[model samples]
Target chain A: MHAQDSSTGSLIAHTESPWRLFWQLLQRDRLAMAGLGILLALAVVALLGKATTEWLVIFDPTTVRLVDKFRAPLSEASALLPDADRPLTGVYLLGTDELGRDVFARMLQGSFVSMSIGFVAVGISIAVGVVLGGIAGYYGEVRIGPVTVDTLIMRFTDAMLCIPIFFLILVVVALLPASIYNIMIVIGLTRWMGISRFVRAEFLSLREQDFVLAARALGLPAYRIIFWHMMPNAMAPVLVTATIGVATAILTESALSFLGFGVQPPFATWGNILADGKNFIFDAPWLFFIPGFAIFVIVLAFNLLGEGMREALNPKLQRR
Target chain B: MSTAALLEVRDLAKHFALRRGLLGRPSGWIKAVDGVSFHVREGETLALVGESGCGKTTTGRAVLRLIEPSSGSVTFDGQELLKLNAGDLQRMRRDIQIVFQDPYSSLNPRMTVGNIVGEALRVHGIARGAELNERVAHILERVGLSPDFRHRYAHEFSGGQRQRVGIARALAMAPRFIVCDEAVSALDVSIQAQVINLLKDLQDEYRLAYLFITHDLNVVRHIAQRVAVMYLGRIVETAGTDELFDNPRHPYTRALLAANPLPDPSSPRPRALRGDVPSPLTPPPGCAFHPRCAEALAHCDRQTPTWIQIARRHGVACHLHQNTSRQGDDEIPDG
Candidate 1:
């Protein structure tokens, strides 16, 4: 907030951008800061895993040692390697699965798959939603060359909204290849309706704002007014929505993988890791807890960040 | 200042369609600006004075094509504004601009003061880079704001400062005519005076013509050389400012003049007009002001009074001043 100088009776320039102010406000929110810390750590680990997966990982997550299958954890791995001739190279930090693979290395690798799908799917969805929604909102009923546009786009959006998004994703995955890329594309396509509706609502309200009229009165082209003048102001809510949408996309991917319709084996996502742990839920509960806990933390971090951002950007809610 | 009018509007009318019920069929129309005709000569201010919902602001917007007129001709320097193609009309917008009423909403919050003013320049391709910044700073200074304030966003400025920025933005286009649509109505009285004075100074400097739309009669008396009083959607009376103030011919004009607050404590407060302004949605069959007009005759309820010339450059649309043959139905009688 800017304050007037009493001494000189002049306006002191406090030209801090809203994002900068939002950051300053967010710094005070301890829970959100904790979320931010967790998110940053996860992102760093994911990036490192992506870069050094072949070189740095001690164990190949797929390598199955039937003799060492279902090893308990660190204690069992060391006990199995007791003598001087014992093989210590295949030690599993987080124990072996039914197929005798390292859970710890798999978890690290799973972060890469889960987080990438989350971000890329969200990015694709935001792009599609913002463009389509902006068009529908700005020009309620417009003609492009010959065909009327707004009705077609909005009716399509409405039709898309009528279907359950998860069901739609399931159908898409069933039709196409069930690879990570296909899952991401399907999630991106299905999940964009929420963001599109949000962007459209923002644009509809912003379209009538005096600044938009002022831009028109200044003889700016319609595109300039819509994209440059109105869209920037409308981005605050879109940004908040996108942040939360990332969490949803991640959760959706995990659920799909758990259903065996997402990323297949050889690739380790949190969902597949959870799927692997389902058989051992009672005996070796660590498999279920590890991946489930990771999903919960990632989603919680994004949600907290999104809520803090909403409060920070909103002028009425900015007060301590 | 030249005698040639910079902007002229003839038979300007804007009717908004009201869509009632679920099917959204047009039920009726709100005649916001019906058959309004006026012109402002260079370096002169023509104030459109009316109460709320009297269509003064609508008239201003209609002239600029911000709200497209239902029917009429808007000629700026003999150019047929409505007839021009989109590109040509946009280009012509450089010469004809408007300053809106609300300061807060008028300026884009995302843009700094410099960009707000420079947008007009840049859009018109008048300047860019160092020249654009220099022009913006210069205009800011001219509007009584510091050049350093250019970096500040719209929210940082007070209402007065924002209004100044609005003025600077309009001036940046170097427009010959500007429609100040209640530009000073939202400001403090002291700030209003300063802005009015600034407008007068700018007019003198640029030889600018202004179509000032406002409900403030006193501000009009100070700033406007001529006045047009609107009732519902029609101009009830128009004359030179002093003449309209002293010998207001129409009942509505008299009521408006009487409503002006007197500063002198010795003077008694004049009686306000009875009844509310009739809705433009369903304007009274004949005279829109008859329901509220103190001097409304029985004939006023039956016939819409045509413009009757009362004196040199003075006209009133009322039966009380029926002293001449009606100005012909099709012809616009004023310059």
Candidate 2:
């Protein structure tokens, strides 16, 4: 068994045309590499970002220590730490907001929300879309509701596409109860139509592929043939789409929050922070600048990664 | 012919409703396999040879019940193929295996060769664990592959190797009647010969019957014990391999022989046929080949010729071959 495992590994090493080869080529791309490094670093920051809020001065964000209203950023910066009113130290580096709340702590905490929302929402959307779209394309007449729901689902997609996305989101948000979970659901559910369409087309082409037919002829179950045998080859486009989809979801979440239906008050969302800091743009530019810059950097990283994946997945680039 | 007919296809006709018109009324029909009939006795290679659009493939598919025939009976070991339900049909499919053309595309690139062959075994609950792996390795060896090749995927192997894997997959079930549906048509000439020779050896060793479908007359002559020549969805002639080549009664069969390019350049120039076949959708009213026939009489266009016994173990369907019954006196093989 040990010898067999070694031989198999070596055989794969010899013949494996795995995505790692393509990703290695992508790692050579300086801009993409930098972008990926920044993205990964940001992810780590998001995961660890909550720890910063826990350690520092985290008074309730809406708590009114009414005396310190409209205090300037640098001037009140020293006052808000666990160590009260000490001479300038490492504590409260970015300083206090008008509410005597540590803005830097809130900002750090806020990142967890942003990245989590972006990651989970996008992950959910991709999961739903890839499966739904794959089935739609791979097995065209597979049921979405009753009696070959393919035509109905497809038509619904067209109708949804025709409706302006912002307005559609507004209607959905209006009818639905307010919550971050609901926000994620709305974005994920709506976005899946594109993936389904893309996946469906991929499946249609792939189902006719010889390997898939070979799998069928081998008497493998339809589900196994569809998911296991066909999905890997058909999913290249969906992968690229999913990468870009993360950025889109993040941007959309930010927009919804800024428009006031998204992450509600008391939650330290970058969108809400950006919304709150909009009036004080000139007075305390750091508030808007920080969230704005974070969104920009993260979105750009995703775009870079997505573009890199597109190149990597391209069959034309597969051969030397 | 052997006593036990492993696969018997009688009066099989697969008609495709080509185009629906006028409130879903049948506008036309494509007689893909029209009244086609043949039988494969135990451990015998029965070749179905014809040109493109001749429905030889259709006959093979119809017999397998891959495409449901409009009207026919396919009896494999005395069981009606058409009467079987989905589960039974699926179960039956394991016994009647097929090796498709274009070996390059016949394998799933994602799967290793072991899985490709072992899939059938796994599906049918034949072997598992160390035993399964051992069986797969043994099967690979049986098809002239190294045991190490099992770990490798299809894309890693060449066309010939992939075909060997295909054969291994088919033989994994230990089937009785294997359908080679233009199995070697896509291979190089040398490779074709290798596969052909391998198939013959495998058949001999396993005592497996085969329905070898091909357009290549030379290959039919080489491997087939008996050959059925199809034309426009009908078997125009069938005879013992030597008898068909030596005395081809049907004109269509003669034209097919003439059209085949001779391997030897020094041989007499091969006689080429005139014009392409008519579409199956609007086939000629009576005898489908009458328009293309060189010796077509007025009556040939009006009436279809009956498929009759011309000689011992020989049959022909042609207006010209009516005198065949009287001309050649021999004991005709009773159906």
- Using lDDT as the measure, which candidate wins? 1
Query: What's the residue-level lDDT of A311 in candidate 2?
Result: 80
lDDT of 1 at B27: 89
Q: What is the C-alpha RMSD of each candidate to the true structure, in Å?
A: 3.3, 4.7
DockQ for the candidates, in order: 0.41, 0.26
Candidate 2 residues A67-156, lDDT tens each? 444444455433444444332343444555566555665677778888888878878878887776665665564554443455665676
Model 1 chain B lowest lDDT segment of ten: B325-334
Specify the poorest-scoring 10-residue window by lDDT in model 1 chain A: A1-10
Backbone N/Cα/C clashes per model: 0, 2
Q: List pairs with backbone clashes in candidate 1.
A: none
Per-residue lDDT over B140-201 for candidate 1, one digit per residue giving the tens place of the 0 to 100 score: 88888888888877777778878988999999988899999999999988788888888988
Return the TM-score for each candidate structure. 0.93, 0.87
Angstrom error of the Cα, residue A50, model 2: value is: 3.6
